[model samples]
Target chain A: MIGQGVLNMNTISDKVMFYRGALVPMAATFAYSILVMIYVIIRSSLTIYGSMPKGERSLILWLNGFSVAYSVMIFSLIMAMVSSLVGAVTALILKKVLLHFNPQFQWNKVLIISFTTALALLTIHYLLLRIFLNGYMTFDYPETFLFWWGFPAVIFLGVVVVGSYQFNKALLGQHLKGNSTSN
Target chain B: MKHIKRFVSYTLFFYATTALIYWIFIRPLHLSWGATFKEINKAMPADSLISPNRVVTTRAINIQAPRERAWPWIAQTGQNKGGFNSYHWLENLFGASMVNADSIVRQWQHPVPGDTIYYGKHQGYQTISLVKPNECYSLGGWSFYLHAIDSGNTRLIIRYPSMEVGQSRWTSIYYYGLFEPLHFIMESGMMMGIKHKAERQK
Candidate 1:
């Protein structure tokens, strides 16, 4: 019974690892999408608040600027680190998904997909900044914020692309060896 | 070969389309937001704008002192007051020294319309479009920059365009409310120090 209990614990841990590998990209994508949505809403609200009465408007602008700046810090600095860790861990899980669908299908496609997805996110970030922040033409606040945050966002996207590829390659190379034999 | 070409074409077409759309819509809105923000900021009373525009407080100071006394104080700025002068430090950092680029003396010579000097910074040059010696000092074709209000008793105006990034809002607020007092202390203190030197020499 003690031996059986140890076996069960090992199996459970393996299963957990398997699922974690599969979930990384999806989770990162989900987080990126959610943060973008939040940014969109906040940017819009601040834009509207700027048009109100002078006293009220200034107050709103200050509050919104401070909030948005802080939020970007949380999203980029904190969330990116977490997501990168997730990407680093689950590199092989995507291969399983591909393998299950078609054994011959290459895991390279997952890397391509991740790259395209990261690229799309980056493009969208720029578009949003250009639309809401005015591409550095007018005020110093939004323009300055964009200048500072812009590079980090690019770095994050790059990580997403490269990290996803390495992770997928590593995962497929490792687990798929045994997993493939069984199939 | 045909399939690869088709894929490349599609990717390129999609990228172009999306980029164009983003440029058209997003860029404009961002500009609009900035313009709106500027309007709101400029709407504040001149004085209100002062505290916020500091590091180089452009808000004019109306001094009871004669122009000669004031000029000396202004010229002698950054002499022997702890370390370096506030204006000199500011000028060094932002390069918005009101003085001639060569001269340490930041004086507006009976500045009048058509006699504008460039007050440097990234905000673009401010033309001293108008200057009435000992009476007023205006800049840019529009009436902004330092304006001397009265002769013997002058109102020293420092017209700041807007705040830069990294300049905290709280700093801006603190500047307007407290700067004048600090300025009064520093300038007055410096003046007294200067006066002591002159009087002792006599």
Candidate 2:
């Protein structure tokens, strides 16, 4: 009966593993994007109002401003979705790579692998930004690139990796307790 | 259904965590550039641009050159004058026919208050509001200051103030969201250009 129970728990864990690996990172990326969007809007708004001259305070001006903000928000939302998908794929790839090395999951190994994956993703992102938004992401604003893109990518990867690990551990722990109780 | 709920909960957690990290670590760093708490809060001559309820941005850089060496670069910044030592291509894209000077031009070095400094052909001009040779100057709403930290180093400070012309929240959002980031990139490049010029001259 104990052997049967262990097998049952393993099956359940196997079923949930894919979901945990993919969804957790996706959700984290989406959330981070939303937070950044809000921040950018607020900061940008204060800057605009401060700079506008007294003569330019017309209804048409305000409308134009709102239209621009609305357009940017739309663009950001699309990018956020793309980033979420990328993050999910990265998490899944990391899990597969780690499993190839060791069947048993190790927190230290997970951290190391995830960090490397994050760095690789950051390089890809930087290249993409350079190719597309060359004007905005030029070498002149090295600090901006580091702060705006690099820092956030690191934090996102760290949070998703650790969060998913803790969550899976908790789920396994609960299943074990349930089996013991039933016995 | 359960999976969807879990995903939503985890997303909220990540959002809160990321937001907290940015607020605590990143926002403060971006808001003020190389300025101490006292220096950022201190009233500047540019404060007169928008006396009350004004928004001010302060950015500073440490130049290896003396105040005098950096002063010439600042003095000749305008559309027709020695163009703001920033990216000429980028400035040109914004309708500016800028040719950044590699060395100091003796003719453009002497700028007095009330003199007009054009930004671009059709964009606008900033009238020189204040001038203190090798020390400080204010043009329209922006003020530039040079402090001699020692014989070899100078702290270049710039203060930009804009009046809050009672607009709806939407106006502020638009300005910051679309225009401000672009402006920051150009301005930051300009600052680096000045530093590069000053250091090379030294």
Candidate 3:
């Protein structure tokens, strides 16, 4: 799920901020992917090259490691780009839907809107998988729907709502301190 | 140095959050498909494949093919028969020697309830427990149900209910953390393979 921070865009500057924030998640994903790729290479090397001579093994390991690292880097870049695009679109759709339902923007209403948005995104995801990826939906649709859709929605809303609240508080504190200093 | 620290912190937070969502929410959801509470809880013939104590994971796909067309591909799933329709190279790496059938073999089309479906060399196999021609079948702890959504469409549902006997705490952790995620990759591939094969049948 895209960060709820992305939902606060009101101006071109806010969109720029959203993109800037996106770098955090993208960099995290890239680093994590590289770490996993390295781990996999090491594990596979142990199993496949364990019996080989030390010198030959190290040479093969370095060669294979470099290739895997290269592939991982390329894959991570693609992943970052694709996910950012998806996140942007999801954020836009969510903002639009939230505005439609809760123009006043109560906290409770925001939570509800976030939940609804998440479900909408999940449904679209399921449909896409079915149509394009030949993905299966579970036989027990009700349980699957609740757990799959509900858990992420709750987590996302909690993170966003809380994060935004804390951010606002921090900003307010800074502004108040500035005023005091000026006075 | 401060910027690097912030970057590392941010990266860790992002990674942790994504991982939590995936393990707790996304993985189970994707693995199970859109099964209902009642459908998952209901007893299936495949239940006989294992002792009653187990975790049942069920997934369903709507295929643009009739049940008859889909049945043949599933009926012949084994090492020497029609392959599991997953990653052939990966299977071969694991000593499955899997050669996925491009065309359904006529001889392998008549699997019975007592027959065994070999997964790989060391990978434990599944025993056929139930067979309902063009409708349903159960092998080991997994059951496959083909329901006609319409004249031209079928809902292919696969249920895997495995017993938790002899599993240590570490094994359980490994099962959830690693085995399941890897299993999903192959199983999802198999689901797609079945869909493609059935749809291609004229």
Best by TM-score: 3
Write model 2 residue lDDT over A148-167, tens digit each, in one string: 57556776667656754664
Q: Pick the candidate with the highest lDDT.
A: 2
Chain A vs native chain A, TM-score per candidate:
0.36, 0.60, 0.58
Candidate order by decreasing DockQ:
2, 1, 3
Q: How accurate locally, in lDDT, is each candidate? A: 0.39, 0.62, 0.61
> Once superposed on the true structure, which residue ranges of model 2 sit more than 4 Å away at CA?
A1-183, B1-27, B163-166
A best-first ranking of the candidates according to their lDDT comes to 2, 3, 1
Place model 3 in a CAPRI quality band.
incorrect
* Tens digits of per-residue lDDT for model 2, B1-202: 2664686676556445544544454334544555667777877766676556666677776788898999999999998899988656545644466778888999999999999998865567889988889988888778888989999999888877653657578777655444444454456556667877888784
Error of 2 at B171 (Å): 1.7
Tell me the TM-score of each prediction against the true structure.
0.29, 0.48, 0.49
Q: Is the docking of candidate 2 incorrect, acceptable, medium or high quality?
A: incorrect
lDDT of 3 by residue, B141-167 (tens): 677888898999998888876437568
Highest DockQ scorer? 2
Interface RMSD computed for candidate 2 is what? Answer: 12.2
Instruction: Summarize candidate 3's per-residue lDDT along A42-110 as a digit string, tens digits.
Output: 754563353233443554344334434444444456566765565555555555565456544455666
Off by over 4 Å in 1: A1-108, A135-150, A174-183, B1-202
- The fnat scores of all predictions, in order, read 0.00, 0.04, 0.00
- Of the two candidates 2 and 3, the one with more favorable lDDT, higher being better, is 2
Write down the C-alpha DockQ for each prediction: 0.02, 0.04, 0.02
